[model samples]
Target chain A: MEIELNDSKHTRNSWMERFETYLPEVVYGSIDGIVTTFAVVAGAAGAELQINIILILGMANLFADGLSMSIGSYLSNKSERDNYQKHLHIEEWEIENMPDDERKEIEMIYRQKGFEGKELEMVVNRITSNKKVWLDTMMKDELGLSEQKKSPLKAGLSTLVAFITAGAIPLAAYILAYAGKYQIDPFILSSLVTVFAFILIGYIKTYVTQIGLLRSILETLLLGAAAAMAAYFLGDYLEKLLV
Target chain B: MEIELNDSKHTRNSWMERFETYLPEVVYGSIDGIVTTFAVVAGAAGAELQINIILILGMANLFADGLSMSIGSYLSNKSERDNYQKHLHIEEWEIENMPDDERKEIEMIYRQKGFEGKELEMVVNRITSNKKVWLDTMMKDELGLSEQKKSPLKAGLSTLVAFITAGAIPLAAYILAYAGKYQIDPFILSSLVTVFAFILIGYIKTYVTQIGLLRSILETLLLGAAAAMAAYFLGDYLEKLLV
Candidate 1:
C-alpha cells in the first residue's frame, strides 16, 4: 500500500492512525494467540481426543491465556514507563542541583558524538542554556530512554482484542464441524483456517512495520506451520508411548 | 544488582558485555519456547494421548519451532538493520547533494524541540558544520531512528539457545516418566517443573529489564499456567465434540 508520509494533514485520521502505537501489542498478541491455540487443536487431533474435550480445552485457553497475555503486556509496559519516568525525574533533579556537572555531562555526550573545541562548547552551551533541552538530552543520551508515553490500558485492551480475534481461527473449524457444516476432518479444516489467519496477520504486520511484504507473510506462515507440525508429531508419539 | 554506569573502564569486558544487545532476543525466544512446547504437552495429555506422543510432539516443537523462531528473529533483525543502513546512506547523499534542505530540516527539528532565535540558529549551524554530526542528527531527529548495531547472527544464536533451554523444562517430566522414574501423572510433574521454570524466567526477565521482581515472576507463572489450562480444556472439549 502507498503510505504518504505527509498525509496526516490532508487525510482524516483513521482507526489505524488513532491506534498506531498499539500495533505492536496487537501483532504480538495475535501471533501468540494463533500459534498457541492452533498447537492445542493440532495436538488434540494427533492424540485423537474427543471433540468435546478439544472444545473445552480450546475455549478455556482462548479466554484465560488471552487475558493472561494482555495483563502481562500491560504490566510490562507500565513498569517500563514507570522506570523511564523515574529516571527522567532523577535527571531533572540532577540538572537543577548540579548545573555545572550536568553541563559537563552534556559536553561529554557531545564530545563522544565527535564534537570538540569551539564547536563542542557552542553545542553544549546552546543545549544547557535551555533546561528542557538539557533534560531531554540527558534522558536520551545518558540514560538511553525514550519518551514512549503509551497507555497501559489501551495496550492491554488491544492485546486482549487481538488475541481473542486471531485465536478463534483454529477453533472456528471445529466449531463449524461440530455444527455439521463440513465433512472434512476438523484438523484439516483448522489448518486451512489458521494458514489464512497467519497470512492476514502477516500482512497487517507488514502494514504496521512497513517491512518487506512477501517476507513477512512467509515468515509468519512458516512460524505457524512449524508450531503446528511439532505439536502434532509430539502428540502422536506420546500416544504411542502410553500404549 | 548494582549497575555502575562508568564501570566500563574499571571492569574488563565480560561475555555479557559482548552479548548484552541480544538479551531481548533471548527473552523473546525463551518465553515463546516454554509457552508453545507446554501447550503441545498439555493438549496431548488432555486428548488422552500416550506419554510417547507427548515427548515426541514436545521435542519436535522444542527443536523445530525453536529453530524457526530463531531464524525469523535473525531475518527480521537483519532486515531492520538493512533498512536503517539504506536510510542512513540516503540521508548522507541528501546532506551532500542538498545541503541547504538538510540544514533546514536540522533547524526545523531543533525548533520543534522549542529552540528559537540565536540558540536555534547556533544548534543548526553547529550540527551542519560537521558532516558526521549532521548525518547523525538527521537520522535521529528527522527519521526518529537510532543506531541499533546488533549482530543478527548473535541474536539468532541467543534465541536458539534460550529457546531450547526454557522449552526443555515442560518436557522434562515426560522424559523422566517415560524412563519409568516417576509414578505420578506426568502432567502434574510437568506443571511443577514448568511453574519453577516460569518463575526462574521471570526473574531473568526482571534482571534484564530491571523491573519489579515479584510482579514479573508472578506474571510469567500466571501466563504459563493460563496457557496450559486453556490448551488442556480445549483438548478436552474437542474430544467430546468428536464423540
Candidate 2:
C-alpha cells in the first residue's frame, strides 16, 4: 500500500496516544497488582495486621512487580533484536554461498507481483545486482516484514514506571484508610479506588484504540467488577466452609 | 529508513511463524482458562455442589470467557480503526487549509536529516508538485503514520478464537479431576497446565514483535505465573475475611 498524508496537528502532539498505548500493559498489570495487594492487606487487617505487615506486602509488591515487568520487557525486546540478527546472518550466508538460488527467488517474487517476462527479469536483475537490494526484497517479499523496531531497556523501564504508578493507588488507599492515626473506612476507601482505577483502565482504552472511550470504560469496569464480585462471593462460600 | 533487503530467509514461507504465534495464545489461554475454571469448579464443588453446579460453572467460564474475549477483540479493533480515521480526517483538513505550512514542514523534516537550504528546497519542490507526493511527504515527515494498518476485526476474531480454545484446558481438567471419575491429581494437573500455557504465551511474543522464541516464552511465563499466583494466594486469604 501507498503512504497517506494530512494534518500537521496530529503530527505536532501525541502525549495522549503515547499514554494510551501504554495503558493496556500498565492498567492490566496494575489492576492485578492492586487487587492482589488489597487482598493481602484486607486479610492482614482481618487477621489483625500491624501497620508494619501491611507496609511490608505493599513495599514488596511495589519492587517485585515493577522489577518483574521491567525484566520481562527487557528480555522480550532483546529477543526480538536477536531474531532480527539471526535473519541477517542467514541472509549474509545465503548471499555468499548460494547467489544463484537467491537470485532466482527474487525473479520469481517480482514475477508474482505482476511484472512479467523481460520486465520481471529486468527488475530482478536490478535488485539482485546489489546485495542490499537482494536482501531487502527477501525481507519484504518473503518475510513480509518491515522496519519498525524498539529498544528493550526503554520498554522495560516504561513498564516499570507504569507498574509503580498504578501499584501506588491501592497502597495509598490502604494507608489512608485503616493504617492512619485515625482509622478510616477500609472497605469504602479501597473499593472506591479500585473501582475508579478499573474504570480509568477502561477509559484509557479509548485513547489507545479510540473506538469508544465510553465503551472501553464500561468494559473495563465490567471486567474489574466481575473479578472482584467473583472473588467476593467465592470468598463468602470459602469462609463458610473453612473459617 | 528505506526498506532494505537484509536477509534471505525473509523470502521464505512464513506460514509457520504465523501459525506458531497463535499457538501459545491458544495454549496459555486454554490452560489458564482451565486452572481458573478449575478454581471455579473446585469452589463450587467445595460449596456442596450437586456435581451439576460444578459442571455449570465450568461450562459458563468456558463459554463466557471465550465470548468476552471475542467481543473485546472485535470492539478494540473497530475502535482502533475509528481512531485512525479520525486522525486521517484531521490531517486531510490540514492539507487543504494550510498548503504553505505543510510545504515548509516537508523542508523542515528533510533539513533535520542534513539536507541544507537549496538542496532541501529542490527536494521539497519536487515532492510537493505531485498531490500524492505531497501527501506522502506529510505522512512520512510530519505524521509518521502508516496506511498499511490491519483489519481490527481480524485481530479481534483471532483473540476470540484463541481464548475460546485455551479456555478448554482448565475446564476440561476440573471436569476430569474432581467433577467425575478421574485418576488425576487435581492441583498437579491444573498447575502443570497453567505453566505449560504460560510457556506458550511467552513463545507467541516472538510472533508479534520479532522477538526470540525462548525469551518471549520465559517473559510470558513469568507474567502469567505472577498474575495467577497473586490471584490464588490472595483469593485464599480473602476467602477467610470478606466472605
Candidate 3:
C-alpha cells in the first residue's frame, strides 16, 4: 500500500499537477474556438458562398480569435499575479518595518479564531518565530490570498494551442473540399465533424464538471447548434435582401 | 469604528452577500451578451443589409444566445450542487453505519496535521463529538469540499437579466434609428455605443480583478474589436464573392 501510494504521488508530481493547472484555460479556448469558427462557416454556407470562401472565413476567424483570446488570457493572468505580488511585498515591508504592529495583528487574528490567553500567545509566537511562516499566515488569514502562482506566458501558449487545435476541427471538411478530390458536400461534412468536435469538448468538460456524459454532450451540442443556426439564418436573410 | 462596522455589516447582510454571490453570473452574461450581439450587427452591416435586418438579426441573436447561456448556467450549477450533495449523503451514511472507521479516518487526518498521540486523539475527539461539526470537518478537510450552496434558479435568472441588459446596449442606436427621425448612421452609432459598453464591462471587471482601469478597458476593447472585425470582414468578403 505504501509503495502504491508513493508511486501515485510520484506520478502526480511529475505531470498531473501541470495538467490540472492549465486545464481551465484549455477548456475555455477549445469551446470558444470551435463555436466561433463554426459560426463563421455556417454563415458563409448560408450565403451560398463557395467552399473556398468558407475555408478562408473560417481559418481567419480561428487564428484571429485565438490570438486575441491568448493575449487577453496573458494580460489578465499577468495582472492578477502582479496584484498578488504587490500585496506580498507590502506585507513583507510591514513585517520588517513595524514588527510590533505586525505581531499585534497576528495575535488579533488568532484571538478571533478562538485562541485566547496563553494559548493565543503560544500560537502567535509559534507562527511569528519564523519570518516566512509569519508572512504566509498573514497573507492567508488576513488578506485571504494564496501563493499558487502560474506563468502568464505558459497560460497564453496553452490557450493558443487549445484554440487552434479545436477550432481547426470545424474547417477540416472545407479545407479538404478545397484541396482534395473528395466530392462530399463541404457544408454537410463540416457540420458533421463539428458535431464530433462538440462531443469531444463536452467529454473533456465532464472531467472538471462531474456532470453526466449525456447531459454535457447534449448541452454543448444544443448551444453550438443555436449559435450556428442564428448566424446561418441571419446570413441567408441578408443575402436574400441585398444580393 | 463600532458604529461604522455595524452599519456595514447590516448593509452586507441585506444586499452585498447577494451581489457577491451572483456577480460571476452577471459578468459572464454581460460580456458574452455584448460581444456576440455586436458581432451579429457588424456582420449584417458589412453585408450592406438595411437597418431593419440588422435589428432583427441582432435581437434574435441576443435573446437566443442569452437563453442558451442561462440554460447552460442553470444545468451546470444544478449538477455541481447535486454532486456535492450526493457525496455529503454518502459521508453521512458512512458515519452512521460505520462509526469506528469514520472515527479512525478523522484521527488519521488530524495526526497527519502534526498532532501526535494524546493531542491527535483529543483533536479527533473534539471534532467527532458533534455530528454536524464532524460532518463539516470531514467534508472540508477530508473530501476538500465546501458547502457554499447556491440556488440554480436564481443563478439562471441573474444570467438572463445581465445578458439582456448588457446585450441590448449595442442595439440601442439601431432601435433609435428605426423609431426616431435620427440622421446619424445607425452602424456608426452602434460602433460608438458598443465601445462604451465594452468600457463599462471592463470597469466592472476591475472591481473583481483589481487590475488597473486603463489596462482592463484596453483589453476588453481589443477583444471586442477583434471579434467584430472578423465578423464584419467575413460578411463583406462573402457578399462580394456571391453577390
Please tell me which predicted candidate would have the highest TM-score against the true structure: 1
Per-residue lDDT over B1-243 for candidate 3, one digit per residue giving the tens place of the 0 to 100 score: 000111212344647777877887887678777877777677667667667656655665566567666766776788778778877888899999999998988876544444567656655666667677677656655665555457889898999899889989989998898887689998899999999889989998887677789988888888788878877887677667644
Cα lDDT tens digits, model 1, A1-243, are 111222223355566566777887888789877876787677667767656656765666576567667876777778788788778878888888988888998888777666788868877877887777788777766765666668888998999999899989899988887788889999988888888889889998886556788988998887787767776776666666554
The 10-residue segment with the lowest total lDDT in model 1 chain B: B1-10
Local accuracy of candidate 2 as per-residue lDDT tens digits, A1-243: 211222335553477655544565565455444544444344334334345434444444355445554665566556667766677778768978998888888776644444566655655666666566567556545665444356676667777777677767766766665436446656556677877886777766555556667777777666445444444444344334333
Ranking by lDDT: 1, 3, 2
* Candidate 2 regions with alpha-carbon error over 4 angstroms: A1-24, A28-243, B1-72, B116-119, B193-243
TM-score of 1: 0.84
Predicted complex 3: DockQ: 0.20
B1-243 in candidate 2: lDDT tens per residue? 122222444455677656554553444344334334444433433333333333443454444444444444455556656665676667667768987887888777655434566656755665566565566445544655545344555555566566656656655665575445677755456667766766766665556656657766766666645544553454344434433
Number of backbone collisions per candidate: 48, 19, 0
RMSD of each: 5.2, 8.8, 6.1
**Prediction 2 TM-score vs. true:** 0.56
Q: At residue A55, what lDDT does model 1 achieve? A: 71
Residues A125-222 of candidate 3: C-alpha lDDT, one tens digit per residue: 76677677678656655665555357899999999999889989888887788777579988898899999889988888887677789988987888
For candidate 2, give the DockQ: 0.10
True contacts kept of each: 0.28, 0.11, 0.15
